[model samples]
Target: MLLADPNNPTGTAVDLDALEQFAQALSPECLLILDQAYCDFADGERAGRGLGLAQRLPNVVVLRTFSKAYALAGMRIGWCAADPEILASLEAVALPFTLTALAQAAALAALDQEAALFAQVQTTVAQRRRVRQELLAMNFEVPPSEANFLWLPLGAGRLVSPSGARGPGSACAA
Candidate 1:
């Protein structure tokens, strides 16, 4: 099973306890792949728990990307945490030197600036909440979000103007 925590587009997340319970319920043969690209924005227990989950569950692999919170989208740098055996198995079939020198250096630098990284994440979370509130005030039905982006699930053939006016026909040009 593949899951994106603090899910992209919608920005909803499952709590740690719920995640553990769900993992426990899964079959032994099931491999749970957790994509935590935007997990830095998650609050309380849901934040920074991917490595712990990977450590506790043999069938779980936690994937992380530097693209989102680290502001390294152009680098295309990513990583995964899993059981040693699982990692070894993956390494056996993986190509070598996938990371470039510049990207590697940038990733190391990003890790070194954890304080700034987290501060940016907090700012983003605040801005996200503000944007959600503004959209709600304008009568846009925005679901609660935990990521950097917001999801506007527009109803079929309904367009809402900034002044809370709803019009018929699809507002999307495409």
Candidate 2:
């Protein structure tokens, strides 16, 4: 099973306690992958839960990326945490030297500036809340979010393309 903690579009997250229970209930043979791509924008405890679960549960694997908070999307660098046995098996079949020297250096640099990056994340979270509040005041049904984007449910409403190319049922240009 694969699940994104802070799900896209909606930005809703499963409760950590509930997630732990669900993981415990699953069959031993079932492998659960928790994608925490946007976790840095979420609350600290919530963001770190996946890694804790991965460390404690043999069947759980947590995947994280530097693309969002670290602004390394172009570098395409990400990582996963799982049991040592599972990691060994993955390493056996994985391509060797997939990470370039430059990417490694960039990732290291990002790590070196972790405090500043996380401060930016906090700022973004505040902005997300402010934007959500504004949308709610405008009568848009914006649900509470823990990620970087807001999800406005426009039922039966026309969609607008980002490039201003109108498709069927589009309302306006970008």
**Which segments of model 1 are wrong by more than 4 Å?**
156-174
Model 1, 1-174: lDDT tens digits are 999998977898887889989987899679899999988888766787878888988989999999999999999898999988889999999989888999989999999999999899999989999999999999999988778889999856536855565565434433
In candidate 1, position 146 carries an lDDT of 71
The C-alpha local distance difference test score for the whole of candidate 2 amounts to 0.88
The regions of model 2 sitting more than 4 angstroms off are 156-174
lDDT of each: 0.88, 0.88
- Deviation in angstroms for 149 in model 1? 1.0
| Model 2: per-residue Cα lDDT over 14-132, one tens digit each | 99899999999999789899999988888768876899988889999999998999999989899999999889989999998998888888999999997899799989999999998
lDDT for residue 104 in candidate 1, whole number 0-100: 89
Candidate 2 lDDT score at position 30? 94
